[model samples]
Target chain A: MSAKIRLYVEHPLGAGQSVPLDRDQAHYLFGVMRQTVGAQLLLFNGEDGEWRAEVAEASKRSGVLICQEQTRPLVLPPDLWLLFAPIKKVRTDFIVEKAAEMGAARILPVQTEFTNSDRIRQDRLQAHAVEAAEQCGGTYVPEVADLQKLSRLLDHWPEERQLMFCDEAEVGSALALASETAAQAPWAIVIGPEGGFSEAERKRLHALPQSHVVSLGPRILRADTAAVAALTVWQQRYGDWG
Target chain B: MSAKIRLYVEHPLGAGQSVPLDRDQAHYLFGVMRQTVGAQLLLFNGEDGEWRAEVAEASKRSGVLICQEQTRPLVLPPDLWLLFAPIKKVRTDFIVEKAAEMGAARILPVQTEFTNSDRIRQDRLQAHAVEAAEQCGGTYVPEVADLQKLSRLLDHWPEERQLMFCDEAEVGSALALASETAAQAPWAIVIGPEGGFSEAERKRLHALPQSHVVSLGPRILRADTAAVAALTVWQQRYGDWG
Candidate 1:
């Protein structure tokens, strides 16, 4: 609700130091938003946390913000992870934003056999995650992992973490699986692509010791819907439901 | 999957009698799907349920299909209702489609003070609901109710049906309020608009004997996300979680 706050995860913030924002950020803050000298702003580094600052100087091409004081402390994120196969561009961005806002500790893009988009712009997706965190007032940002093959992901899967596979073919409901799996250590949600996971992939997932296949419902949901639906179900079952 | 089966809700099927498909349904079956006289199709009514049929005659403007045999019996929908404030066109359509797929028995559009789009085309929304029902292989189409003001809706509220208000301001975790209230009778999920409910409306909702203001999470979700999230939580708690 205050003046537009743009967060950059660059170097640390200190008192009476002018840090130049990136070109795009500068354009957004200065050109689009029309912020001038002495205007109040907010900044945050993942380590140092949030800070209130003031624009010390303004220019057509660049701008500088001088850090004033720390507003909040850096907080560690939960160990929840979100693994989803890429869909269309807009929906992918929406997933990234919603995942960040929903407090996923990590976001992993899996390349299944039915995945439509293999050529994902990692940096752009990362930016959207950052924006989502900033917008939702989250101090911790989730790390976006590079795209990996589904088989390769399972190959190097961590034994300690539990993977909740949102299997559409599962006969029973998701709530039972979610409640049972919520008591486990660390958890991640696995969402399939538009055409859904191949039968072989589903078999392999079912074979994994750490994997638990759960159904969202009787209806056939799109990949994007599945992502959000699975996340909501998981959060309600585990995470911070209290 | 089999020849793009076009489903329609019409009269009961008999062995030899040919039923004339509506003009709109005919256009979709013949012109849009490019089905011919011998094409296989499906038809269903709320009473006798789904059936297999074959196109007896195909025309550019209209067509007729002869019923072959019954496939599945009529399945009753769950006693669940989705009450949400209508948002933008695409998002409203999305909510209608998802609600139908998710097996809502009824969809009610509520008009709050903060609701923006008052000119909701009920027929268009109903069509979307029908399409979703057909696509999801549902025999019963959820009834889309006419738009009613929030006050007016509450005035005539059914005393037995419990209302789950997805309250964003709730501090604690989201859980089914009390089994006594949830288990008493039918249930409905109340989702606010983008701007959320007014303070007075929130107060009135809290005062209702059948209302439970439950939180979704710590993070604030968009209205559309809130709808899906609330429904998932409800289904997990009181609906068919088994």
Candidate 2:
């Protein structure tokens, strides 16, 4: 059987390359997973593709793995970004994990006017993205941007990327992606906070030329649910799901 | 502003009708939520539509609510069922909650050949469904069926209900719902366990005339993510999302 354990490392990965493991990684591979010398595993970095590596040296605090061969080439996801207001801790982690598994190229947490949580642990969220990528068998991991204000984000928004604004109040516009906007690359999906967007924020979003205001459905979905639904909808219509 | 709290109760709801809250409900409304006499809230039973209610009598252990008027008529979801193999505890609960929020008419836990968890707490999952419905502002709560063997479920499968079988192995057949089957009511989506379906199980599923084998995407998603993604896709094409 192929390697069941997939690890995300920061070192370069190629045939004949040796990777050194940190203390945490050593304990995880040796003590927790019960791996020894010559055990096979898959390794991947953001820049490199997946590689088949075997334990060359094993110890309690540190170890080394030598890459044997390239198992899979680097496969980048579609140029799609997910921007959502961070909710509770667990739900925020869920969103990041789901975003990585669903092939999001980037994840941005924006602080809105009614956002419940003002600050977010970007490092923690980034670690979640890495774990998700590892567990989901993804070759590339999405970058998690630090939390920023929604107004500033909109002001400095990339002009080329279209925004799929999920308007919870606009139940009538039922996600008619075929007619609303042409399915294309370089897209972002924006989900609001629990209390939803202020009237001014909605008006500003509506006035943006790059925004395609749409609704998930008739029901009032929670912010987390909205994120997943919006990602699924966007991926199906515009991304690489098809 | 309208009532911010939506609750699911077992009692009948109607104009001027008085309903008694159980101990847990009384504790939640009166003690936890700090709601007193004259406070208004929205209530829904499985059979009745959502009704606006006023607190007639309030105490720490008991309370009474008088219905004011129907706020939302019963908006039943399309005839869709979600069949999934139970994974970890938190993920299983996540599946039930998402099923309720995403418009599944029923949720079934099936024990497949590769299923790790053979038994599930039906009552706990059902409670989660109710909570999800209450939080999502859904007037209808879907039923959560007890765990059963996959073979038994297939033996008595409904002929009219088409099955959207999500085969993780078939990465080639992208989810082409439009071409595979005509979008209609009375459909079900089946997601396998983390280990995926056994070969025999896959063969049987493929042999079934009602099964439409499809893939979520190129990346392998966890069971919970697959459930949500499959529901979103099926709802967008076959259910009431349009």
Candidate 3:
């Protein structure tokens, strides 16, 4: 079996590097998980590759781990941003977790015209991303940005990045990601809210030169399902996982 | 806007067909949603197409709906079955919901050697599938089969149906669905449990003639994520999501 305990840390990792655990981490490792001194676990600090670490000190409120060897190199995901409208609390959490596991480079919650959720807890969602990365054995953890307005983001959209707009209205249309764009290019997938994009938002997205309005399928998939489906379609054709 | 309430009924749907609502359905439509007489809603019976129905008789204990016109013909999902080892309760419900939303014709919970869940509430999972169909505007709800042994399933595997085995061990291999198999063929996708497949099971699967071992990506995906990802990949290439 793979390493059962993989953690996302903040300290830089190298051979013989001693990393101090916070109160919460210490409690989790020593008290909750019953790990003693010299217990081995994997650690990744987002920038550094994964490392095999052994517990150097174990206490109730504090603990330390010393890096033994590098397990895997940092493998970054393709330059893909997932822009989605937040829904219910549990489903929004699901979106962030799945995005992190599915190899999104960055995740941005966009407030669209028909979006029901106007606010989101960025810290909690970011923690979910980190937890997802830890569970999926992913060395690279994607950044989860704070919620933002979709219209404003579109106004200052990057010229190099292609926007994949998942339009529920565009059913029966082909997913032309592979045919229209090259692989490994800067791309972002935008999924609408549960209420779907408004007429004006749809018009604006269709008029945008960088936007590629593609359909997931004939059926109207829920926003969460659409996010995963769009990511899968894009990854299968344009990103890694070929 | 689309129909505010979409219900799955067992009665035949056609013009002037009066369908009786069950006590549970009545409680949901009347008590919870507060629908009165003449409230218009959409209904589908899986075999028949969707129909516009009006509350012809509204009572505290029961109700009746009169079907007016055929709104949409029955659009059956692709003949794809999802066979997965059951996981935790919520995640198992998620897999069933996603399978119904993503257009799986049938869902089977298989017991693998590494599978922790030995028994599952099949009726509860079936209700989840119905709820998913109701929310996603899907006319057909996939049947959730009872838990069975994976080895027994493979023993009686249909010769004509191709098996898309999502093997986490085969990470770097290409998902050669398009090149290896023809579209619209009878197919099934099998996802392993959280602990993954045993060595004996993997050997047997690899030895199966109809098994197509494919990889989702480089990183290890959770059981729920893998189910959605595998469905999306298969649907895009060989199923109905083109």
Candidate 4:
């Protein structure tokens, strides 16, 4: 019933390598989590596989951990990205956390005409991604990009990456998504804000050759729920879900 | 773009039928939502199809509406049940809310050996289910059953209903779930708690003749996220989603 706490580190992880903890990490392990010297926990740098680390020193504000052994190999998530328009503060955080846990390699926040939030706290969101990875036993932490306008993002969109446009107005089921060629091409799922995509934005997305408008189901889902549902369908169809 | 406000009512909806609203509903429509007499909105009673209703009377503590026409037919969710061990209050509410929005016909909270929460507020959860349906534009609100011990529920388990047991120990993709018979039969998706099922519980589930062990994906998901993933896979395979 007890699982070792997993921490995300920015330093390299290797045997005999001593990793320094920042003030917050030290506070988390020592003050909040109540860990002491010699305590063992897993650490991942999103580069190295997860490593078992021993608490060499535990202080209130600073500490160090020495790597003992590699517990798990670094397993990268699929080359998939989740592009969504930010909604309420809590819901936006929910989307990022779920996307990280559900195996999205990257997350993009898009600014559409109906988008409510003007800006996003990128650092905060990236930290949430890291926390989600740590909690879900994921070795890789997906990067959360700065918010970008939909038009600008579309202009520089990667042509080869298939875009699974979750259009609320779409009529058919998403079963056809599984029939798409299961190639090694990268993919992205775009979810609109609570107000949905503007007409112009929808037209532009539909015109893109790489974009495939797919429906989630018979009912309309909130933005955060749509993120999970779309990611699930995408992973089941082509991503390494199986 | 303004979507009509949708309300859940208990009265039958028909042409010229006056629907009485309670104190909270009246305050919601008049005070918070700023709707006046003659304001049009949608209403559903779970038994009847969604209907367009016009406010015939409006007050801070009470209101009345006249049904105009049926907007949507009563479309029942697939005969799917979501059995899960409740976790934290907010996450448990999230699971029920999402289950209702995602088209689970019924929700059952199970208590396993490893289940952390000692008790669950069934009425509160049911209210959350109704709120979710009201917000998501769902006509059919899934019933949130009171918490029951997993063992007891398993003993009286319906043999006709196939249980898609989401075993965290199971390896491989959920695509295998799609291969199960696509006949129109009852189905249930079982999700354990954060601690997961005990070895004995897992053994019992595996031994059940109607249980099919399936993995959600490559990564291990938390209880709430796992619920969404399992439901998505089930709907895509046998439910009304795809």
Candidate 5:
């Protein structure tokens, strides 16, 4: 952890290997961040663990970094997915960023019957996830899946993965579903859009054999806040936070 | 629960009573949110429970609502406070807004050694708190205190109140502080600024008799995310969410 500046790179990292930086990475390191030849930093490639690398060559639009040693092993997030309908642009970004920071392994933007937006900019949202991981000192970045219809996703739902269906209408279930899941099982947390789930959608979710409708709490949370809050509680109850 | 719109008002609410709105409130209700005469909504005054109300009159700069009846009794939040060093403008607002939505009883902005912002707009932050409560259908609005010195606040800290000190440096304390606090005792979650706590400040917090240093998780989080995560975990472990 000698390198205070950590960057996520796509190249394979190993000792005595030279990693080439793309134009954007070169400009970010040399021009924007003021990194230079001989400067040290940490790099992670999602496959390899984090590595300590030193600038071997610096240029305006190209650079090279020589991996010195491994800094940290890759720490994968929990076997969890965040499934939600995209809301407003900014809040949707916030949900993805917070989900990345709060230990979600995958981010899924679901399209429900009442979901307002017809489509989402998948590339933009994925970039936000990457940026969140970079800023939050995370070694692993969650994949941001392209938007999918909730109905289709439910039709192909993995029976092995427990679904923590967060519903405001089921507020007083007496027993929180957080307690029922086995600690190591694959799981996903589903949150609706601002308009919430339609009657048919709610009924379909309630009838799922693997779905566990969990209440977030007594208070009504906006869709974005509910996503972060759900991740936090789940991490506290059974994720890596414990 | 029948009312679609929720607004926070300062006037007393009861059956057949009129509640007047200020210019901003009127503009929001009449112009932005488009509530016209005879339109029904929900109102809460912090002092009273939520009440169903109907628009009695609509105007350019002022309006009135007559309370129909009480819809919900006051549900007091757990005696929890969120204390954190103010960061950048948008994030500070986000922290206050989420704290209000996540069941924090009070919000305190404390000056610390590593705090970058010299001062905060208390009124603006408080407005954000109110907005969050209104949007989340919260019956109670947490008071946002003006910025105060951490040392002075600690000096006057109540003995009965327990502090959950979120420290990245103390990441391996397997037992979460949430389990240590009594269910109904006054509690506060302290999050450091973006630059994190100075060594001396961290030492002082660790030495405090009332403070229990706890780790958020293996991964590092931004200051705003940490505040929300802390509140969420607290609510899940011991607060009203249970």
Candidate 6:
């Protein structure tokens, strides 16, 4: 079996402190994993770090864990964000999983004119982010925000955070832009919908001071492929690839 | 509309030559696309290059196209192969699509000890590859080889072709390996099955002289994710990342 690491959003975990897990966590720990009292498991809080805990009481619907000691300290993630248009259900899930695995600090779904999916379950997407983080052994979970209009996102864009826009219309290479903008700046990758950014949206993005329109390659990639490809380019250019 | 390109395995294509398309091609061009006589299209042969063609005759089950002029020369693809253990049906199709989009010269499905799906429909996978190539506007199509055992593949391993084995067991950085080996030789990325490589299989791979065990990152990635990540790393290092 894989390692039994559980994440809780509750208070400080101390030695011999009993903490009752929420219904969902308890179901996963006791019902799904079939853990009884005295079973050992790892726990992590977004703030205080990861800790080893043991089951103090187990029930069919709920379980209690007593925190023992710290396993690892909380470390901040890289200042990188992933902003993408939500595609089909499965592809959307894939984007979130890969973004979390690739160490994105935050994930935001944008609604563009050409975006197909209108009903995005933010809670479900957030759960996927959490599961991905848990599977990747990351103590810090990237925050998943609700779906917002692309225009609104642009209006509230942070001036300091550079936006590396994966533009299909660009004729030249992406490496030059990636290398030029990758030098110690808070960066985010913006992937358009399958139909791509609308003409008006592209024009506005081109006008942004911090936006760099980069081409992935000569071919036109699907939105999901573009997301991963753009992320790979970013990681190589400005991320912790060194 | 996107470029209408038709692929044929026939003789050399020359300017001002009327060619009869077979029943299947006719069904696709005339029945599905609903193109009548005098419609313009593109045709490509592996040897003679790409050509613009016009419909000379149209029937219910057969059609004729006359080549007008050459659009582009037949450029040979890079000598890179993708060897992967087949997974579920959808995922296998996904692998083929991505492989085509990423410019793999050939794709080989190998049977590993822990491979979940033993039976693979070669025809369906080939169709997916063809669709991906057509959509990506690639003149060259990646040949999908029939399933073979991993041991058999290793037995007839080409010494000149280096294998970049994406070893999930390795925990350090992956950038160095990508850079160091990018220029060494023609390479292939070998992705393990869902359960990963067995101990004996890992040992054999490690023992291969031309094999380089490289890590992706500090996270546990799914097999598909690993494949894409490894390819991205390779592309950034040695591919036409222009």
Across all candidates, what is each one's fraction of true contacts kept? 0.48, 0.69, 0.70, 0.79, 0.73, 0.46
Segments of candidate 4 deviating more than 4 angstroms: A1-3, A175-182, B1-3, B175-182
Tens-place lDDT per residue, model 6, B1-242, is 22455555365689988788889888888888888877888777557777888888999888888888988787556688899999988778888888877778899999998887777899999888878866766677788999999989999898778888888787665644444544667888899887789999999998998787777766667666776777777766666655
For candidate 5 chain B, the 10 contiguous residues with the lowest summed lDDT are B174-183
What TM-score goes with each of the models?
Answer: 0.89, 0.97, 0.97, 0.97, 0.95, 0.85
Q: How do these models rank on DockQ, best leading?
A: 4, 3, 2, 5, 1, 6
- Tell the DockQ for candidate 5: 0.66
In angstroms, give how far residue B213 of model 6 lies from its true place: 3.6
Query: Which regions of candidate 3 fall more than 4 Å away from where they truly are?
Result: A177-184, B177-184
RMSD of each: 3.0, 1.8, 1.6, 1.8, 2.1, 3.5
lDDT of 6 by residue, A20-62 (tens): 8888888888888888788888777667777888888887777
Q: What is the DockQ of candidate 1?
A: 0.51
Q: Which ten residues in a row have the lowest lDDT in candidate 6 chain A?
A: A173-182
iRMS value of model 3?
1.2
User: Comparing 4 and 6 by TM-score, which wins?
Assistant: 4
- Cα lDDT tens digits for candidate 2, B40-115: 9999997789999999999888999999999989999999999999999999999899889899999999999988
TM-score of 3: 0.97
**What C-alpha lDDT do the candidate models reach, one value each?**
0.79, 0.89, 0.89, 0.88, 0.87, 0.79
Residue B89's lDDT within candidate 2 is 96
For candidate 6, the TM-score is 0.85
How accurate locally is residue B187 in candidate 4, as Cα lDDT from 0 to 100?
87
Candidate 1 lDDT score at position A240: 68
Q: Judge candidate 2 at residue B190 and give its lDDT.
A: 95
User: Comparing chain B with the reference, what is the TM-score for each candidate?
Assistant: 0.92, 0.96, 0.97, 0.95, 0.95, 0.90
DockQ, candidate 2, vs. native dimer:
0.70
lDDT of 4 by residue, B74-160 (tens): 999999999999998888999998998888999999999998776899999999999999888888889999989999999999878
List, residue by residue over B80-138, the lDDT tens digit for candidate 3.
99999998898999999999999999999999999888899999999999999988888
* Candidate 4 global lDDT: 0.88
lDDT of 5 by residue, B1-242 (tens): 23778899999999999999999899988999888899999999998899999999999899999999899998888999899999888888989999998999999999998887778999999999999988887899999999999989988989889888899887756434444444457888899988889998998899988777778888788888888878876777678876
| Colliding pairs, model 4 | none
Shift of residue B233 alpha carbon in model 2, Å: 0.6
